[model samples]
Target chain A: MTGKLTVVGLGPGSPQQVTPEALAAVAEATDFFGYGPYVDRLDLRPDQRRHASDNREEMSRAAAALTLAAAGGSVCVVSGGDPGVFAMAAAVCEAIEQGPDAWRGIEFAVVPGVTAMLAVAAKAGAPLGHDFCAISLSDNLKPWSVIETRLIAAAGAGFVMAFYNPVSKARPHQLPKAFEILRAHLPGTVPVIFGRAAGRPDEAIRVVPLSEARADMADMATCIIVGSAETRLIARDGNRPLVYSPRSWDAASAGKR
Target chain B: MTGKLTVVGLGPGSPQQVTPEALAAVAEATDFFGYGPYVDRLDLRPDQRRHASDNREEMSRAAAALTLAAAGGSVCVVSGGDPGVFAMAAAVCEAIEQGPDAWRGIEFAVVPGVTAMLAVAAKAGAPLGHDFCAISLSDNLKPWSVIETRLIAAAGAGFVMAFYNPVSKARPHQLPKAFEILRAHLPGTVPVIFGRAAGRPDEAIRVVPLSEARADMADMATCIIVGSAETRLIARDGNRPLVYSPRSWDAASAGKR
Candidate 1:
């Protein structure tokens, strides 16, 4: 039986971020598969099969979704944040392509959603307005050597960075290592915004110095923004705060136009 | 008279990406102001004030929205991507803070929406799954020197980079300059994905080597993604093609115990 797979992005926490298109995709699916925490966001029917697990089981979970889809189920593989940014979209596609012969007839499409970077950027102001990049501190799949190379390049380039998978139960020291690498090139006083569970109920964001940002507080759900030297936090009246990433600033005057 | 300003993200280019909450926000607003190209996407009453203009006029349009909000109008300030990125929310806040006594009392709230970065990331597989940064090449507000600094830092950090406002009428060479800086630290063969008018009818995405990417293509409406060395592209059997950014091959090779 020929089947199809649709990868949907659940967006940042809060139901408000779920687009109508994503909801419609879920409604049309014969089954749903995703990380356990994100699966709870959907309303599943009795006939729908849901394959949910922790992040560690992403590969197996993806394989299972492809298998189900091959068996004639129209499956929606879901992810929190944008499915393409540190989420499950790529994994699912990889699994489908490499899976057994039964999955050959499956059609695939990836639908986009709001990502944590943009969500946190919105919450924290314009820290991402200029050139930026995101890196995961977890070394589970990548060599620390490769990550280090990337970190050095990113820091030297002066691009603002959004860090995902910074720290978790299995790897407690990754974030600190990343911070240390960044400190080599960036000044200690550069602004770094730590966003914990952004868009979730316990959302917390604080601007701290690069040297003072706590590595222990990060997790798969957290997003850390390390700004360029030009990034600044301005405290305005009425408790309105703005983070500005100076895309254009004269080095001689150190003032933005 | 009391008034409020609510900024909404339209989510790339499609109605499917508009969240229920964003729809509700629009329904509740008494006035709406957005980029002229997106004016047709919303259902508005004839009496509602809809302001549209060229992209360069965003700051002025945002100022007008703030003025309307200050004058007892419930206004919805619409941005294509998330308002907090490079959109109108910051401009609105800045205008209100810098304006005369008339705009001091207006209450403002920034709403999150899907961004082009996430859309492009999804289309190009998971180029942003690890660490990444986004920057605008526009020198209208900030200078090229600061942009260079951020680009170098991002490159050194090895974070995936997303570029917004890469080129405009007056700044045609800015994108190439930014590319040159990124090329210095990044590998020559790194994957660079250029998404032109993503999620729109005339959408186009091209994958090119970092060295050969500056072949006279990118423009103001484009969002460019430069993947790290680990990013790879694979062609599927079907008509649909797939892109993959393996966050850490070592983790994937650990073979899911």
Candidate 2:
């Protein structure tokens, strides 16, 4: 009963972004487990078995996949973005570490996919071109105060930030609070990207200055990009402004060398 | 004579990691421009013109791609990893913003690829499973002091850190300096991964503790992944130990909300 388990990232929302490695894992799998929407993207055949479940069931879902794999069924665990980033990879590892010793026998691997942050960064030009920090604003696993602290630390450290799961029904006010902290530490002209549904057909990217950004602009499907102090918004002719942070950094009067 | 310019990420190394969109862009392009090593990856036909140049000439290479595109040629500007992340996308945008305004008239798009940090994270079993920061240690564009500041801030914030261009012939001591800074704030047992040539035929991944990490362990082709305080190293059966950061953050004692 040595079945293999592979956690795969399905990219953002476009099939065009799916890598051959991830595609191969799905094609070779006997069973699949994922959130309903992401599992639906696989379009499985009648022979392919699937276990569609609710979101935030990461640990349970990983345990289930391991249990299946331990019983001689190859499983493909899927996530919307890169499995390694706020997705199933860590959950599965946690499951394997804390579960019965038999769970360790299952061969496990994670195939990285094109994460939404990268897709969103590309769609909104190169706001993440330089140093950056990625934080998931969903406080389901941690406290809201921790999220606020990270946001402030990231802002004060001058990191262009990519915020995932910025706003959900349960976590509505956190995004605004985050923005307030950013306004205190960052310039008002910093470009803020409300990248909703990136890489999808109906993708919409709204770039606003920090002074004009609002909480209503983001939802669960959005990836909010807050550029660093050095980030620039370059205006183009009859096109949306391009956002980016040049590679260079200015650090003249700093702390001790 | 309108032309289109697309910046494409070639993924880490394997052709299998490339997305269909990036391949489509390459197939449709008449000219390619990139660093010598990355350009060598694109085995194009005689009809496809290539402009391979020395490394660190990102701006010039981007200007060349834009110039070719402005003259009615479809061009694909290639980067080894995701182009928008410390790669050619920002350079191209900078050129468009600073170069002749005519370059902006050309249609521009960025097709994201699997960056090395993600690939490295996958290989290491999701060390970046939680919040993380990516800092490029190359001081060519930024001051060395800024890199030190980022290292300290990332460590203090408990964010797993990914270092790009951590070492080179010219910048030999920065990686060691970085380790010194990280050692001050982090425990000695923290995992450090020297992911050299990820996804390539000669890929080598070394998972060591902060106490054992040395500057010479990394090179230009390496991406250094340093785990956070919460990261764990799980022992495997007849395999290298897996490293991952749990999804949950211990924030019971955070500051005021």
Candidate 3:
């Protein structure tokens, strides 16, 4: 069969952020499957069918996409950022593992896109230029204890961290505990960035010290960046300050020009 | 001043991967600054000027881009992948921190792109569908000791890791040491992926057990992914195997079928 299932990441927000590969996939696919918001973002044509489902139903959505592809249809599974990063790519593979053996014969491909944390890092200076980790703080899939252990290990190891799902109405207290864990291992002077709705028109990026980081500063739309020891702030004469980590770590880096 | 310093990531090696935002920035730029190879990739017009330099001279290249922007020329500093990921965004911000005070007054924005690690992860199924970290193994900027420590910590914390610059001729032994460190914590069966020249025509991806991973498997063009303890492999029916990590975890997840 010529049927195929291609997973595409449309990127965070702006239309300009969508790559030509994603656009081309949308054009070629007979069906698009994804969360409601991402499916709504696709440029739908009369010939294209869309299966927009709730955000939490990733497995079911992936199974449906696979079913269509196995029946000789070109399907595209869309994600907000890159499909591989805590997104539908895993779900699609999981579906293949659990579904009918015939589904495994279908062709599958993943198309990457700009993830939110990188976009947030760009908006706020380059706090992630050094050794870094990305962790989702929500305990929806895993235990909160795992998140805590990862946080302490990440902080103690001096890795800059970009936190996704830092705060949500369902899991509000996790960010505060995370900050406390990091603060215990890191200095209070470490730079922390709260980027809300990055790449969107109302995007707001706030840079603060770890000591000043409050749980209230984050939400589901926010991504937090807690910098390593080398993260620095450049105070401009009459402009907003820029936060960045130098490329090199040496004695010379400690002294400013 | 009409000058603006826009740092854009070219998104690995594919034209289709380049976002419209990066293309727009390049089109509007009067002066393009980057490594010789990346600059050659751009479709430069006669009215536009190009300043390509060696890969190691990031600081000077960034200073030049800022200097041109400060002098009323639209400048674009290019990185092969996402600028925020061990690339020119930090260097451009570093140049601003150390350059003339006038350079600080120039407007600068970082446009994100599809980074190499994400592209690699996409090619190798969804190995990074869980919490992960990215660490650059080149000791050019940071010490090997730092790399060793981070590797141990990341492994102990059970983070799937993407290693960039895993094996350069100058740093041949580092990847082996990294594998040794990870082997102490993870199983020998943990799947490791080496994605060489991802998104390019010469692209190749290799998946092997951690026990079998060799330093020669990687080069400067390779991006490596060392999966967590939970990573899995699915044997295809007369096809290549698929590597992916499931979205679920814990005792409760086992009964989902």
Candidate 4:
């Protein structure tokens, strides 16, 4: 094939945050493929072929993109966040590997984009200042038992957490259950920042005590940030509360300058 | 002051990854300030002023940069990874507040850059496919007790972890000690990927089981990735060892395509 394939990250929410490189990659592609919601973000011309489907069909979608590339069409496989982070980059690579003839001579490139974790962390004022981890509560691929064991281990290890896919339409209670598991080991006063659609229109970011986080407050797109015991919400003048996990502090230290 | 300030992220590693917009911001700046290593990445003209320091002194350096900006110097506060992620962005905002003069009149903007967590995660395949967290291990600002607690929480929560500052010259044993704490709660077979100076010359990325991650294997510049129970290293032909943390999977009965 004379064509190439480029996987582009559309960034966490807005087009403004999309890097110029990602924009160029998409603009240069003759065919664009991605999740349905992600494809909605682009304004395509009449000649460009746009293909999108539910996230569940990522493998097939990726395979289709490669097939198109193999036919000598430059294709862009786009993702909402950085393609490598819980996105379609690997799936595309896997698809390519599974079908030797699909994209035999097609060169592939994975472009990085801003991810939800960083966007939510920024919106929440650095709750990820120290060591933290991200976990998805969705059990579609793995059993809940395995997730529970990992949660217990993470909580005991005292890592801050960014929860992706904490809740979805079918599994509304997953977040509360996850929180209960965490509360069992962490202090009740530990902070939790819930960020919905971070960096997008109607973005909502709130800081609440771990004891106060409710199941109804989140959805598939929400990013839940649960802080360790040392994380604190520092209130600044007339600004959003800044959440930060202290990395270090001298007991004899002076106040903020 | 007639000057402006722009805070930019150089992205994780590699000059090729640096976005053109970020480069433009740097090119236009009369004074460049950032962590010592990041500032060294750019080729500078003789007239360009550079300010560099260790990561711990980010706040101090930011404060100094703000002072310079207030005195009419167009300053570019640069960071290796995205400036907003555990970098100098917050410090710049805080310093602006602490300055003798309000910087509200100064044109200030933050340019997004690639982050180490994303870069390392890409290189290792997809260890962060599910939920993950990024935390710095430097206790220079917080107590080790806090770090220990967060580590436990993250581990207990089943969140993959990207550890920054795994070790340092003065604190060579912290990484191993952290590993011990994690091992106490997690299975010894859990995988840990150590990325040293990722994207830079002499970059090294190694995947080892938790039981084999020794203190001597890491240092301050290393970004350590510890996988959740679901994470596994899959051998791929000619493409290096790939790490995959499956988020969802079809029934084994479906058969691998």
Candidate 5:
């Protein structure tokens, strides 16, 4: 029997955000592989088994899952947010490329879901309504210099920036440094949104201007969105403000560079 | 009773891709407003009224929805793909900002769903595995020069780019021109994926090297993803090739500029 491997996104820590297609994929799988927290999010039947590993072991986890699939076991690899966005989908593809040739025959499908940036942007009233870039601030797989270069390029091109892995216990300086670099190119009045655990019970969405934006406002679970020069904020009498980047950009006056 | 306005994403034309939150919002709405095709995607109850308009009439549609919501009608604005990404969420926000102080008093929520780029990336392995940017190639709102500048900047920064609205009957030259500009900055070996109506019945995904990419492969319904310089393709004996951009980058050797 030919085995199958399906990659599914659980959609940013919320049951309501999970799609019917993702749920159906999970229901059809016999085995699941993912980080401990992500795997724990699934309600697997007693007949199904889950192989949970540390978050840093994506490559080995992918390989192990592929091996199980190669042995004719239906397997699913789970990721928080859309699997295509800096998640397990890439790891699985990399594994198939480097692993045994027989693994190539395994049926592969990726079920896309709501990514963190989109979830965060929705809660903040569409700060990503215009052109945008998503960058992971963690320097684990890539160097800080590469991150800096991308940040400068994204900001210079007038794209709103959505940052994943913005701050962690080990990487405390990167987010602050990013803010400094963005301030150099954009106005201090541009809004910076820190959306943490969106769609979860403990969700928090905070909006501040670039001049007063701080690194301490974000954590590993947080997705930070920095607005472009044209981004706007609408303040209400007794409610949280709405932040959004306008869809129209006048080339006659703005962002020729 | 206070009125409520909810914006929901329908998720790339597939009913299975829609989230529970979006469904709930749609069910609760007394009136729906959107582009005709997007509004038609919903199975509305007899009591629910739909106000379908042309695609270019976003501002008027948003204003009409807000007017209904402000007058104590439960309103929903429908968008294909995640509403915040070049969709109705921004239009709603723009309307609220420009319309009236009373519009600010209306309760608002945005329900995020699977975006076209993520759906396209999922269908073609994970081309967005690293830092990436989403740019709309249409010149309806912005000048063609702005799009050109963004393409250059995104290519120079080594970003995988997901292009929305790559080609339309009105704007055929822009996409071809975009390809010409990208070839100057990126290697000809990079992969370009044209994914049309992903998750729908007529979904089509095609992959080609940048040197062989043509604008004819795309349309208004397509999302085009151009892999970064580090992207790789793994061939299979009988299956379609897998394309992905590696999550890791060596700053010492790559994209220092």
Candidate 6:
């Protein structure tokens, strides 16, 4: 059989959140390539091989997966959340673009899954109900300046912000800086949600106002969502407050602008 | 029995894209409620009732669903993509916020699924792999000026844009206008992807440069992704070209800025 490569998302560490399409891709592949924890999520038959690596080794993992597929073995690259959202799909595409000419011919497909932000938003009421943006705070790839610029613009444009890779041991201060920038652009009353390991057994979801949002609230496993100026927090007795941005912004304000 | 309300996403019209969690919710629900087409997507047993409503009647539909759940029925409100993203989740939240006090006691949950933009980006080789924003061009709820402001801010900040509700019968000219505004802020070389009914049998994915992108290329079912300045396109023989925004941005430029 001709070598084929498929990248699929396991979805926020939940077996229930994984789609049939992603599962189908996983079952058909002869080999799996991904970060250790993500790869461990898969239930593989003895005939299938697993190539697990460290989290930061995206480029190398993509190259290795491509090489395996080029050698006529079916390969599956697994990612946590949707493969297209700051994940393996782009890494594989990048590898194919710059790699050997033969690598371009390999059949490839990406099976989308419930990304972390969406899952996180669901756990809350619907902070992402209106316009929103997803930005990864990992400076390992992009500059911190770019992240700052995007955050300001997203807040200025009244788009809800969903942040991935909010904090890590290597980058302890960026999330704080991000919160500071957002506070300047948005009202202090806007809600900030830190969803850790959402959809997983240890999932913890917290909501705080922008004024009280702290860097310590987030870790690498967290996906943080900062509400736009229009985002609302509804009080619910004996339960977590529901947060949602109304579908309609101030129509009167739009007229004035 | 206690009342429960679960909002679930059907995932861009593909049965394969729906998650096990969503399916389980559908199986357990005593009634389904949503827009006509979305409600039609569910395979209901005779005992399971469906309350299909017009697409524009979101508030009423949400109220009706909440009323059912409040009356001790297991209710599931379905949306085409992820319910939290520009879908029914917010509408339900809004209804609960403004409706009867008794509505607060209902158990509520949202099951996230593959959103249209993610499905579209996957088809186009991860155009959203980098920082990105999702906007709706529809002016039915918000003013067009708000959409325009967001377009300019997103483009100026170098964020990829995924547009939902790009064109509809009532709003034919908005998308063309949106393209014009985007063209002003973004380079003409940026790639625009028109993914209609993504992940479904009738899915059609098209890629075009910014200068050549037109309103006719998209419809209401389409999710249009506009790449950032750094987005790349890779060509292949006998296949559609791959489009992806790299994870890394220009670090040198960031330092200068």
Return the candidate ranking by TM-score, descending.
5, 6, 2, 3, 1, 4
For candidate 5, the per-residue lDDT at A91 reads: 90
Q: Please write out the lDDT profile of model 2 over residues B160-199, one tens digit for every residue.
A: 9999999899989899999998888888889999997777
lDDT of 3 by residue, A65-168 (tens): 99999999999999998899889999999898888888889888999999988898998878888889999887898888888888888886778898887888
lDDT of 5 by residue, B15-68 (tens): 999999999999999899999999999999999998999989999999999998
Per-model B-chain TM-score: 0.90, 0.96, 0.95, 0.90, 0.97, 0.96
DockQ score of the complex predicted as candidate 6: 0.88
Task: Name the best candidate (by lDDT).
Answer: 5
Candidate 4, A62-138: lDDT as tens digits:
88898888888899988887887878877775665567753535766677787787777766655665556667678
Q: Model 4, range B1-257, lDDT digits (tens) per residue?
A: 54788888888777756766678888898899988889998778888988888767877898788777877888999988887667776667666555554564566666667788777776676677666777777776667876787777676656678888778887776777899898887777788998876666787888898988887888777788898665666555454666756655333511211
Q: What's candidate 3's DockQ score? A: 0.80
Reported per model, the fraction of native interface contacts reproduced equals: 0.67, 0.87, 0.90, 0.43, 0.91, 0.93
Q: Every model's DockQ, to 2 decimals? A: 0.51, 0.83, 0.80, 0.34, 0.88, 0.88
Better of 2 and 4 by lDDT: 2
Per-residue accuracy of model 2 over A1-257 as CA lDDT, tens digit each:
68999999999989999999999999999899999899999978788998999997888899899999999988999998799999999999999999988888788889999999999999988999999999999888887776787888888778899999899898888889899988888888888999977889899999999999999998899999999878888888799889998878755311211
Query: What docking class should model 2 receive?
Result: high
lDDT of 5 by residue, A91-127 (tens): 9998998888898899999999999999999999999
- What TM-score against the true fold does each predicted structure earn? 0.87, 0.97, 0.95, 0.77, 0.98, 0.97
Worst 10 residues of 6 chain A by lDDT: A248-257
Tens-digit lDDT string for candidate 3 (B122-186): 98889989889999998898888878878888887778899988877677788888888787877
lDDT of 6 by residue, B19-75 (tens): 999999999998999999999999999999989999899999999988989899999
Task: Report lDDT (Cα) of residue A112, candidate 2.
Answer: 90
- Clash-forming residue pairs, model 3: none
Q: What are the per-residue Cα lDDT tens digits for candidate 1 across A160-205? A: 7788777888888878888988888788878888787666789988
